[model samples]
Target: MTEGRPLRADARRNRERVLAAAREAFAAEGISVPLDEIARRAGVGPGTVYRHFPTKEALFHAAIVDNIERLTDYARELATAADPVHAFFGFLDHWVAEGAVKRDLAEAIGSDHALELSSPVKGMLDSIETLLHRAQRSGGVRPDIDLDDLLRALKGTFLVTHIPTITDAQRRRTFAIVFDGLRVR
Candidate 1:
């Protein structure tokens, strides 16, 4: 019932508020935060939140999709940078830093239902791959590294080092070590 038609101005405002509140709540409290609490935080009723998102998983998926879209846009913009290798690793560092607070959404990205979401996840991946190829062609990155290899290393590092207990300095150190391994020998 909530699909197909365009939302009225007030309804659109409420939906944005719900998403912002949900992102904050999920970041601070994990994905287990209650819908009613999110509604309260958003200054809207629970029914309003449900009307827009349908279910908690749907809301979480939407949030992840939003994050991915932002990252994709960032990568696209970085593609035009003068130094291809700097742009590529800069995007990776930016992503890892942002993931410190938004780590809760990472699991949802890898979830079975992620593909069903509306976000352009594939486009984001393609952007990264393009960056990697550019860096490889310029001899700034190792010849053997591919998109999958970079993704695995980056995701693995973030998953292991982005914990609440880890200091920002520690995260930076870990990222530096990881990036060192990716650089051309």
Candidate 2:
């Protein structure tokens, strides 16, 4: 039996299970969910969890990145939307949802946004930049605004969800305020 090949299938299944469990746990209880609980939810031992992800933080990072890639794909579709305003709002809604889910990605990834986002980030940025350019051409968003600032603001909004006892409605209201603020006067 090939040494590496023998473990490949089992390893892939374990990783997938761990990620699914971690996603549910994080969504239900935020980032503070215990690793042991995640392992139990996955029907795996704690040692297996460790073998896959050494720390809760690392597992969280993986989940966050996975979610980001999916969102970025959605953003790609939005970029081609016929309505520029709708496209912008689509991107906005995506950021808000991802923020609501994992408030710590911005902190772990950093302001530069180079981390956590690999090729998918680049693809999304290209789409976003093109869309922003089109919107600017149509006199939608402010011409003076930079995409980097928008990204930082979006990340900031996500970070706000981590605050204790903030309701989802409150987060939406805050996002509305920021969204209106970003619009061209």
Candidate 3:
């Protein structure tokens, strides 16, 4: 170990703790949450939190990336599920839920030059393509549909379905309508 330059294990722990707390704080309270409150939540000094994150946007980027990775994993799981239809709907539900979190993170992460669309977005799109292909082959989704149009429609659904006050039931209804329209006769 480099005695003079190395951060101790305890110091490293504090850094991670601060990031975790900041994520929670930002999720609950947005980017305007006090650094002092975040430090208190982490059981660290404000300086330590500041040292780890430097800016609120930097902390938000960490949280956003973490969340995107989780969503990506879920997409991978859904892509390989036993029932292709169930997997597709499960992916949609997960997308909506994650989109809510992304909605908040986007306000900060969108403004930061550091943030970019993660590869999972592309992976998820490809997964959706595979699912749609399978469903179409099985006479589930309509054969006449263009994949790009389908993707655009689903993205439109994401935007429409993002309202905070909308119940899951409402989302289900909306999803059903969308699914019904896209299904083969």
On TM-score, the candidate that comes out on top is: 1
TM-score to true structure, per model? 0.80, 0.74, 0.58
> What's the CA error at residue 42 for candidate 3, in Å?
2.6
lDDT of each: 0.80, 0.72, 0.67
Error of 1 at 18 (Å): 1.1
Model 2 scores what on Cα lDDT?
Answer: 0.72
> Highest lDDT, which number?
1
Rank by lDDT (best first): 1, 2, 3
Q: What is the lDDT of residue 56 in candidate 3?
A: 70
lDDT of 1 by residue, 1-185 (tens): 35689999999999999999998887766577899999999999999999998889888777667787888999999988899999989988788777777775455443455443444777778888888888888889998977778767876776777566888889889989999999998
Q: Candidate 2 on 103-141: residue-level lDDT in tens?
A: 544453334434335564566666767777767667777
Q: Predict model 3's lDDT versus the native.
A: 0.67
Looking at model 1, report the run of 10 residues with the lowest lDDT sum.
108-117
Residue 11 Cα positional deviation in candidate 2, in Å, after optimal superposition? 4.1
Mark the regions of model 1 whose C-alpha exceeds 4 Å error after superposition.
8-10, 29-34, 104-112, 115-119
For residue 93, what is the lDDT in candidate 3? Answer: 63
